[model samples]
Target: MEYVASLAFAKEKDQQDPLNKFREHFYFPQRNGKDAIYLCGNSLGLQPKNVKAAIEQELTDWQQCAVEGYWAAKNPWLYYQQYCSKPLGAILGASQQELTVMNTLTVNLHLMMLSFYRPNKQRFKVLMEAGAFPSDQYAVETQVKFHGFDPESAIIEVSPRPGEHLIRLEDILEIITKESDSLALVLFGGINYYTGQFFDIPAITAAAHKAGAYAGFDLAHVAGNIPVELHNWEVDFAVWCSYKYLNGGPGAVGGAFVHEKHASNRDFVRLGGWWGNEESARFKMEKGFVPKKEAEGWQQSTAQVFNMVSLKASLELFEAAGIGALRSKSEGVTNYLEFLLQQLNGINFQIITPKNCNERGAQLSLLFLDKGKEIHQRMTDAGIIVDWREPGVIRVSPAPLYNSYQDVFHFYEIIANIASNA
Candidate 1:
């Protein structure tokens, strides 16, 4: 496809897009009385137009049905998690039986680690990417300490080579091999938050299996941004937040996946709650904890009906758009963004994200030589919503759901303007 940097060309592309109608489903932030170009879906997504109605329905159910709303509401608050299953299954590439909507990402991470990160004396080390999100770092650190192991010794971080932003696949595989003897678990973010590099899940999973270790991922950035086959990849477990690419509202309910082999195993050890008990037995309130014979078995509490309603509203859009189609459009638009950024001659910055579309999602991380914050502020002032990280990187995420080709062009225009002024 020939790329053009003009606004007219952008409008042409958007005009021809089948998913273009999706942009209307979200309510973008207003700036100067106009819709702002929101590219911050990698942080918090723009709210879906249906969210208000979704919340209201729940409120109505609570008012009309009171305690009986669990069974009486239109959505049945007792089974609210079920409403999200089909769409989340498609987005995360796992079967409904292998998936569950639950607590936030880090809490789910801790639960999965407790179930899968069993570190014995001979094989007690956990391998993860260096510079993972702080929550993951903190969770792994505390989990190691809770298990009475020195974090410095029990946690092994694989870092990129000197002066490189991306962690190479070979390096990850090599480290797993080198630490095979003592490695108990291999955990990574499906896509690194800072670099936006999409890690090779199948390859990593195979390597961990070959090394006799369990493989897992925090799919905070990967779940809705790209297609993944967690079950096919034989990923032992995975977790994600809904607010990012999933377009759930702020602090939306999180999701988790457990491979069928483990999800169906009646004896799989996990912290259990009444909601996870067999439905038939739940009302009995007995002593024995018999978990559901699937991913819901990991649930530790009743569904957060209000916390999950927004995600339920958002998933309807995903079901209509399809993750596969979204990924296809993502590759094309993200490529256009890269092409336009490359045409900028005035900026002293390098794209730190992997160049290959297959190795990344919808984000581009601009590593500026200087004035990173200044340029980020310039973009904000120009009504282009993007994110900035420390150490000179600004994250521009063009979410395929709501962002248009025009949005990319305008983002390029703002950056080019900033560069020209400098």
Candidate 2:
């Protein structure tokens, strides 16, 4: 993975990249009638070229079949979610019975909490990383309050030591041991949005289990960006949104997972819905809920056909490329970004993301001590699209599916010129 800070070198890497042709699969934003250098896939992914055709097919089905589209449509809307299970199961490292597509992230988080976060006199607190995505913080806080506990006291957050940028593995494990008596659940984002740190799910799950607590993850940043073994990790449950690395279009359908051990436990305390019932009994319009024996039991309602078609289209590309193939490309491109950024002598910034490839995904958070926001605007003006976060960070991600080494090199060139001027 030797990298050179030259356009020809960048192009050469792109030329050799087996996944480089995937750039054509996405629609990039236009700048002066040309495709912009898009490094913001960690925010909102580029649209798949096949999305329109996929949606149009559904549109045609709805028009021709009307209400009968549920059964008569090409994909059969009644069981539309089944279409995604094969690919998604591979990405999450779970069996088909252990995972299912469902509602938005926070909604699914609340649902998982309902079933997995049951607490008692000796164990009622929840342990999570500090600086998690705000929605997670809110979900955990409200869930604690729902069970009649004060959030401040009921929630334990592990933070980095002073002057440190990332949480240490030992600290997390030690805190789990120290708080084992009170911890009812251990929840975390698979990858921290701001720091772009990929937590060790296997280690985290083992610690939580040893502490006599259930473990879950919000995988919004982890799903398609890196490889995981959720079933092998024995995580109790997990949830994720599909828009970011999954490239499922904005506000796409979300996914949820539970271990197979819990999938058949009809007595589990889950918030049930009509669609979640056994399919044979579902149409009987019965009075009581008889849940399905699989992850489908957690479903609340019918699939959102329109919302899922885009994801279906995206998943096809993922299946063809394979998660392992994508991860290899992701590492190469992200390393190229780090290499170029390091060559900049005085950029008034430091990369806060973990330097180890396994410790991160596709993103690099450039923490600028000064003019971070202004530099972000400059990046935009220069037709380089990246995300900006509070305080002073420019989050750049060269998504392997649609971004190239040239994209990272160009970002470095623009920021370098801006830094020199300052």
Candidate 3:
């Protein structure tokens, strides 16, 4: 596990990487006619090499079949979304019955809350971290307001200790216990986008249950970045975007999860469409809505065949590499990034991400006290494609599927030189 700060060391590791060939599977952004060191997979992933072909195939289908593509296309438009279940379910640790590809991340969260966040006079509050992604914070706030409660009274934000970067697990458990009587739901991000804290979902879910609340997650930064057992953890619901670690192209179709325990609850309130109705009676053009037997019942519209084409291409890489093997490689890449980062001289930045391997994914969020934006700009000019968060944080994520150890070393070199110059 000893890591060295040299190109040779990185090259050696890259040579040994089983996932090295995957780097070729993606088309990285070009910088001076070479691949840029793209560490922003946490934001938007590099496009898969096959994405064009995948999209073209769908375009061809649409052209050739006209209105008949609904059933005549290679992957029938009638049930096109079903194509994702096997590959993606494996990563989610879910049965295909529990998960379904549908709307974007926030849209699915809104839909899930409609069913799960059933608050009463006695229990109407939602509990979550203080700094959840802004969209999630807004969603919970508006949902509470729509139910005729003030957000100030209905939302409880559990905060970190004044000097600490991460929220304590004990603090979360204690708050859930204290607010048990008033908590209608407990929603949290699977990983905080800024700090990259991978939450203890199983523990949090169990605690939420004990506190008599439904537990759910917005897995924008965690899904596909790490292996999560939404089914085994008994997560009531979860949602994720496909463009980040899943390596789907920008604005890709996202997905949702609902536990099997909710499978038979046909009477629950849902905003439905004909696509969600059972397939047998769908074409009958009946007046009443008869929903499907599983999570697919939550679909509000027909599958967006074009939107999912790129996602299907990306999942093929995951299926080929396997999640377990990818996670192992990801740990190595991030740890090496950390090791090399610490070796830089005169750098005044703190890595806010959890140091414990189990508490993080591939991202390392650096809060810089010196030359923050300048350093970020310099890194960008040097062809290191990382992202800078508001205030003074830079997020670096070496995605195992496409990023190589040599890419990590080059990024380190750029930063080290910048620090030394400063």
Candidate 4:
């Protein structure tokens, strides 16, 4: 797909985009009264215009019905979470009973770990990618300590071979084969936050199961950015935050998936709470806990009605646009950005993201040979919003919902000019 180098080309592409009309649904930020070229959806997504109305409905119910609003609201706050399950399941390619919207990412990780991470004397080790998001690392470390094991001795960190930027499929398989005797779980991020490399989830999951280890994923960066089949992949469990590519506002509710195979396993240990109790008997205030038979059995508290409302608003948009269509546009947008960056050869800038679109989402990590932070600051001053990671990586994500081809073009133009001037 050849692209023309002109504003007219961008306008033409926008005109042809079936999803372009959806951009008007968001409140884009402006700098000095002009719309800023926002490209940092990987960090925090722009708020949807409908979010205000969604939140207002909840407030209205709270004011009108008081305590009765829990069962009397328009959507019925008692059952509000049900509104999220089908749509989210569709987005995740999972069955409705296999998923649920619940606590934040790290909190959900702890809850899932309470049930899945069953370590013993022989099988007491947890395996994970070396450069996973810091929150996941902390969660795993804390879980290991809770189980009376030293993290250094009980946790296995997998890294790419020396001098390599990405992990090879064979290396992961080899580790699983050699360490299966002591490994209890294999936890990994669906996509690496820094390098933007998407791991082969199916292959990894198969290897883990073959070696008698449970598999899970932290999809903070992958959810809504790429297509995932958690149920079909036979992954034992997974958790993800909705704030990133899901466009659910900042710190929104995260979700979890428990394979149906484990849904009826009463022997699996979990931290019990009223919310996870059998829904029919929850209000009875029974002395004993009878856990629900589905994924909702993992919840520890009542739903956050307000945060879930924002998530519902964003999910309605996703339902209309469809993940397949969104991913199609994402590939084209990110590939074009990569092409433009490569055009600036010998400018001391390089893209660390994988070359294959199948192996990455919308983010491209740029490593500047000199003055990375200065260039990032210049781009910010130029009305382009990109996120800077530590050391020397600037992450630019062109979200399919709100970003246009013009956004990518303008971003490249600013970076190219900065490199030349430097």
Q: Name the top lDDT candidate.
A: 1
lDDT of each: 0.93, 0.91, 0.92, 0.88
Q: Give the C-alpha lDDT of model 3.
A: 0.92
RMSD of each: 0.8, 0.8, 0.8, 1.2
Better by lDDT, candidate 3 or 1: 1
**Residue 293 in candidate 2, Cα distance off native in Å:** 1.1
lDDT of 1: 0.93
Would you estimate the TM-scores of all the predictions? 0.99, 0.99, 0.99, 0.98
Q: Residue by residue across 1-422, what tens digits does model 2's lDDT show?
A: 57789999999988988888988888999986888989989988899999999999999999999999999999999989888776898899999999898888999999999999998888999999999999999999999999999998999999999998898989999999999888999999999999999999999999999989999999999989998999999999999999999998899999999898898899888988988999999999979998898899999999988889999999999998889999999999999899989888656899999999999999999999988888788878888888899978889998888898888888889888987876
Model 2 residue 69 CA deviation in Å:
1.2
Best-to-worst ranking by lDDT: 1, 3, 2, 4
Candidate 2's C-alpha runs over 4 A off are none
Put down candidate 1 lDDT per residue, 1-422, tens digits, no spaces: 89998999999999998999999999989987999988889999889999999999999999999999999999998888989977788888889999999999999999999999888899999999998999999999999999999999999999999999899999999999999999999999999999999999999999999999999999999989999999889999999999999988889999999999999998988988998999999999889999999999999899999999999999999999999999999998999999999999877899999999999999999999898898889889999889899988999999999999999998888878888998
* lDDT score, candidate 4: 0.88
Tens-digit per-residue lDDT, 1-422, candidate 3: 88999999999999999999999899889997888989999999989999899889889999999879999988888888888866889899999988889889999999999999988899999999989999999999999998999899999998899999899999999999999999999999999999999999999999999999999999989878999999999999999999999977788899999898885577767778888898899989989888887889899888998889888999999999999999999999999999999898888999999999999999999999878999999999999999999888999999999999999999998898888888
